[model samples]
Target chain A: MRPSKLVPLAAATLVAALAAFPLSVARADDAGDHADARPAAHAVHDLWVTVQQLAGGDSAAQHPARPAPQAVPAGGPTVNLSDLSHPPDIDAKLHAIARLPAGAVRLTVPNGQARLGDYSIGSEQTSTGDLLVLHGNADVFGTLRGNLVAYDGDVTVHSGGVVTGDVLAIGGLVHDQGEVDGEVRTLSAATPARTAAPPLSAGALVARNAAGVVGVVLTLLALGFGLVLFGRPSLEIVSDTVSHSFARAFVTGLIGQILLLPTFGMLVVGLVLSVAGILLLPFAVAVYALLVVVGVVGGALAVAYAMGETYTRRRLARGAMGSPNGYRYLVVGLAGPVAIWLAWALFGWVPIAGDLIRGAAILVTWLIATAGFGAALLSRAGARESFAGRIIPPEALTDEYLWATPQFGVPAVRRPGKR
Target chain B: MSGSRRARGGRRGGRRGAVALLLLLPAAATLHAQTMMDASASRQLHGESRLDARIDYAAGTLRVAPADAATLYRLQLRYDRDRYLPLARYSAADGRVALGVETTGGPGLRVSSREHLAQEATVALSSRVDLALDITLGATEGELELGGLRLRSLSLRNGASRTSIRFSRPNGARCSRASFSTGAAELEVTGLGNSRCAEVALDGGVGRVTLDFSGDAAGDTRARLDMTLGELVLRVPRGMGLRLTSDRLLASLETAGLTRRGGAFVSPGYERAMHHLDVSLSSTLGGVSVEWIR
Candidate 1:
């Protein structure tokens, strides 16, 4: 390739890659942002804890003999230090304690002690049981026979310091320069664990399901009416194709479904190999998806029209008195699937029976949709009417031919006695 | 007159039905919900001389590093509670531990996306103990820093991930072998010399790979790399004796500083260099390029 060709090719390749980059890496970017936010949150939490501790200390000094009250939280005011295994539970406990009103707050640590501010253990000192340190770093210069937990603070195990149990620092880091006979952990800024939403009641579930079904039916009805108003001729052709060549339409739809992925793969590979056509890859993909959606949806609606037309003509043949039009045919055809779906929507809360009904509804809908899709393909999206049973042979085209087709509700004429 | 009134009544009913449908659409959309939670678990070192650690993470970001001398193993996780369960099972009898996340009957074959970020895990293993580590990743971005740890043997199975295994410092113990099997991933192994392994093997499937051999080498190393597709970039120290034998059918080799010697490629001072490296590569469709690192 010449330089002139190469430059544009390079530019196109760059543009294509840039355009495709977000689809592949958008999630990664969001993940990175979340990771970055965590550290910032930790810093903010530390600052808040520091200010609160300072304010609390001054207030404690003012009331020399006053005993601080316990702060009530979901995990209760007391944090049991016996088991330091589940960190989130401990975090929840401490998170509540940390949010206590700024003044001195008392925490009950069973079999251990709680410190309000920065705390330290001397080289000669030995503390037993689990120790809870709040709003400050815990410097361990001596042996701690129990677990050490620092909430909104750091924990440092210096040389010669020995911790017999686990050391955990919430919203902080663990700087271990000494031996810990147990595990060490550092948890990032605390966020409450979100549990799955409560299951809906049977009545509520039915209501939701019914609403979903109604929304879908109404949307389809609206689309069907538009098709009737704007594209009745093509729609009728496709609908007639479905009624006349249901079997052929169904087989074609099945083959189309099976070939969808392979066909897409081939198209992509062909475009990519063509090099210059790579610039049109994204547009090609979008167009392919749009075509598939149109085929399936439009075909399904056409099937409904065929169904409604069949039903209405039969009723009219029986001398039923009612005005007939494309709109009524669409409405009548749509009612078939809607009725099945409504059955599911109303009784879907009935466990086994509901699931069975839903499955059947899906199967029937797919059956009709496949037939519709096949009809659309056979009729060339209503552009060709070969399979629509509307073709009249040149020799058979007489004044009686129009009357012979009673689908339009015109009464059929009798043949001559001589014939 | 009655017929006309019936038509008006039907129109009014149609208008009411449209309004009802508009109200139903919003209620239909409130059915989706997800939950994320955090959990941590660890085990203390108790005179254990060796350990077999297995990590199985399905998705998200993973980090594995050497823990403090006092702890045997530790894992911190933030995961989708509805989709996965935190795994931290330890068998004291066999000196083995399983750490990471496991599926809780959730959808299988989850691809990397924004939801993956919510499931993260950090695993730390003791540097004091001899370790045989096995890791499996799916749709993950991982960093496994194995340096400064006593590694006996290593095996990693990567699935559709971007991962880097780095030996930032010299291994504390001699490793028998390190094997990696990748599936459609971008994998990089840096400071291969520091890994202190007698043999390194990589089986790659359709992804780019970079192998950097730069550090203090104790002895001659043997590396076997097999790539089905994608590029492989090799970085070796300038003063190393490098001999490469390749079985490539549709792959290109770029040996800028190496001479072809009887169907094999060899560095200038292959016979007398301080450190020796022998590489046998098999590639079907891709390109392999060698770079000399100082």
Candidate 2:
């Protein structure tokens, strides 16, 4: 590869690696002493001190550009910038600064003897307010009473310069030669750290996806539990219906779904046409919704229960456990369906496989829900003895033989014995 | 009884039946020959400044957007000609335009699945003129984008369809009232604040309904929502004050960042807020979820 192409490739690889394994890199760096650590710590400490001075109202003045007497101890406030830079206070201050008006001049370093360009702050200036240099360089040769901010630029303080406040360089370098007081900070121009938008770490992504999956699983489990608790018998009937006539129930459910909207519309129109029907519209709608929910929930429960029963019986045949009850069946049924859904959610992190799995899960769930709903409807919401009543023949109406009854044919012949 | 007289009566009846069958054959053939076709219609604004328009469509993908500067309204339709055709009429006298694409044949006409019609209508209004709109749809997917329009009043009704109505831009004039009614349809309306309406009403049945109040409104507004059988989701802007009154039966409600007062959910600092939304919700058998967004 050409040198030019290799550079870009290397950069890309580095970025990808950082994004893929940010925690590993951080841990490795922390395990060993790094040259950049000391400087970073020093800068943080200085910035904290500046924030404290400004927050304490020690540097408040009407004319921010006016020079003030330095209040420095023998070693210049022995404040560890680290100790003063509290995360909460820093966040609050940043938020306050962000809320300031766009055109408001928060700080200014005076144009002194040396005429510096628009992008540079002069050296002889004594700025009492927060000095902001936009896409420029701040060459501080004099005293800076307030915080110095160089955005997308460089800040250089000569040996003769003295800054009582914090020094911040965003996307630039901070060459501190003589900073008597306050914290000093520098952010690399290559990174957009000042924007506070870092690529999402892989760990975070995995954690988020995992949390989402867990939440969905818990919700489904709760729903299943509720179904079993409130409508156990109905759920079992629906399950039996599905087990006995899966294909029939599925086809009926599909048809019912297709016709649901149209039927509802017709009913609504009818109600609107009739004066008395209008009054019952709300009640009718409520009943319709209740029926739909029952059908869907009942159908799903039935599928789960059937799966559970089969598994349980298989285990029993293998001499695994005691006789199974409704609760056991419910657990088995819910577990199978929920497991499928959980797999779908967990594998969603994978590109193609996740989508395929999700699609399959949705298709299966819809089929089961629809079929269950149809089965429930067929059973008259579990009021009927069986959902397969249409296919099953009714039992004989009478136990006595018709021919035998007639054999007593002439009532007189039968009565002879009685007489 | 007379055999000859009975035979004569039967012959006469047979003749009448044959005549009736012969009469229907031609009509049936004509109906059967009606196939799907693409058609379009457009009208330019001549001297009219204001418009009161009504659009009635059934069983098709309906799309509505702003028209070009020169045209007032343009309609593009792809439908089974035998089943339906587009009809448009404009009256300059009262500044009223009625547009409808309706079924031509009687009910139960066999329309192949592939022959489902698609209708798109684009309408332009004079910035200087006020407007009133009424729309009705049936068993169709409908999208209406009404923005940067000087609307006076609006009403929409739909049946067994999925619809989305949006206003990306604020209204040029304040609307007195706006209403929407649907049956067994999934409906979403975004940027209600842009409607600049004093009063809004929504009536829904069977399917999901979403009302997004996420935009800068000129003043406070009131909305009344009535639903049955399905869920209702309300997206409210964080800064906008909200007060809600609900009448529910066998339905669950999930409210975020709201305090209950006198049987109503009210946002924090409701009394002092500059802009407020007062909502009255009535539902049966469905759930309601309210989300506050910035």
Candidate 3:
């Protein structure tokens, strides 16, 4: 709080801020390049893949990073670190790993492999099967030799182990507890983007903004339609019930996302199959058609929600009826149809955006539907009290609710608007 | 904020509204309120994934960043061999003119600049200056173009954008290995009659590329085309030994004194067979043809 004393502190703070670049560059020495890429972005697409898996009735949750985490097999890859003294059974069995920097290789199960360069010796890295080795950390354990590239990772060399190429983990941290004769080419770069980069083009800016607006509108409409179909009062009851429970809603949402996405992909596949089957397989086309309808409804619902939020009439009417009843709604009025159609038109023209919208629609549908269910249950009050309550479900959150009761699939009724 | 303004106004609260109403307040005019910092043109080299480079003296160095990642291009000119000066920073974020090479380096360097319509980083120079351009184009549609400059190495990463670069100035000097993979972009050397190189391999994603020899090759050249799904076209001069291979290759383009031996085209330069050859080819999928021109 001392005004004069703040000078040193200010100077120190500035120094610290300026030091970020150099420190980051130095710290990047050990950090995982792949790790920095992050798996969050993949979640959306992979979840859709999982949805496809789930809709086809296949076990998609089994795969990691999907909405529904698939249960890993009982006999998963065993990593007994205590027994890490010996080389993994190369021919015995090892998990198929690929593009692993040139020194991080251990075998235990059956897998495939591709190695570039030579990490053990100079010029290039050797290769082996199942386990792909990159020469970031150039140390070979046991007796392994093959073509693996020693790019930028460190290497670990066991006493009896040997490699064939140069371990070029130049800027990366190199543990010299190994042996290699190949030269190291040090590639140094100046400070990278210290701040967030500006958008390269105006169109990209417009595109991102548009996507956000469209997504928000879609999310709101889903809630509105749910209210309209189930009736206002019931939706209120369910919504309140769900608001009381945080744990239940999170888990249910996670599970639902896992189940719904891939359904569209499978529908596409089914459509393809139906085309192949011609008129003989009417069921495929019918199923595909059903999915299309749901997609259309979901998108229309989103547009309607955007409209209702932006428009005064619907916002006021919905407010009187309460939030839960608002969601039990659908597209209405000329403006509603036009907005919805415009969205559809944009999506149709851009295939990439269209696919993205399809996925977004599915996600939005699930989000609002559950939220709707929670709202209805909340207004009704203990609508699912009959069911055994281990804990509160998604329909009973303190802030927002989705279910009229604790059970997952149950939908609640709507209520009438206030005078 | 409104409440605080009212409190400050005390007896003359009405005046506060007038104060707020004024545009560009006298007091505020002097105050430097916080605002967004300007985005200085920055091209930090994201270490390349693939290194396939060569060296030959041409005009200026063509610095390329060939990935979807926002890449800032730079120029490192040195007073001596070990130093450099910063030129400019550019990014291939827009599918519209992301990179353009101005033909205004130290004279005798005829730099014809053209920024293509694609999200890739590239700078094409067609001059006669003995300058070295270090390029770092990524593997995501990341491409680098060199018409008359010397290169060191061409690097690439896994699943990166395809890279295709053609080394021209066919008769000037020769280069070493030009390795490409993942991303699809290439260097199509043309107008170079009898030019040659050490080794060339077009890996997967190292897509539809061509190393055209307009007239002829310089010395004995060695080239290999490795493609998973794209195309590769090589133009051989008038007469020379030709060698080409793949899962399937079509010799629709004619090459004199070239006979099929095994699955490879045998055009032995025998030495320096990449001079004075006009080879124009389009592969439907993945096709490769290597021939030695006169």
True contacts kept of 2: 0.00
Query: Per-residue CA lDDT of candidate 3, range B1-294, in tens?
Result: 597776777747657667675754866744532111111111222343222222111223233422223222222221111112122322223211122222224333212232111111123332222222343333233334444443333333324334334444442445554444445455444433332445545455434556564443454445555554455556665554445443434323343455566754455453464322222223333545555444
Candidate 2 backbone collisions, by pair: A45-A81, A45-A82, A46-A182, A46-A183, A47-A183, A239-A302, A299-A372, A304-A333
Which residue pairs of candidate 1 clash?
Answer: none
Task: Give the winner by DockQ: 1 or 2.
Answer: 1
Per-candidate TM-scores read 0.49, 0.43, 0.28
Q: What lDDT does candidate 2 reach at residue B147?
A: 80
What proportion of the true contacts does each candidate reproduce? 0.16, 0.00, 0.00
lDDT winner among the candidates? Answer: 1
Each prediction's whole-model lDDT (CA): 0.81, 0.66, 0.37
Q: What is the DockQ of each candidate?
A: 0.13, 0.01, 0.02
* Per-residue accuracy of model 2 over A1-419 as CA lDDT, tens digit each: 78999787667655654454444334424432221332333334334433433334322222243222111112211212222222122223333432333333232223211111112223444556555554334656667776665544567776767777666554456676765355454432122113656755655655776677678656656776787788777666777777777777888788889989998899888998997687578778779888777677767777777778878989999999677876677677667656666776567657798789878878878877887777776667666655543343323312243334544445533433333
DockQ score for candidate 2: 0.01
| Candidate 3 lDDT, A1-419, residue by residue in tens | 89998898666655654554344333432332222332333333233433444344433223222211111122334322111111112211222432322244433323323223222222223334322332223335433342222223334444434433322222233332433322111122223324666644545644665676567656655555564566444333343334444345435535544655586567666666767543323345557566544433332343344334335455666675444325433344224444543464455345587666656655655555454333322222224432213355534453224333333544333311211
Candidate topping DockQ? 1
lDDT of 2: 0.66
Quote model 2's TM-score: 0.43
lDDT of 2 by residue, B45-85 (tens): 44457888888887767777777655566555555554565
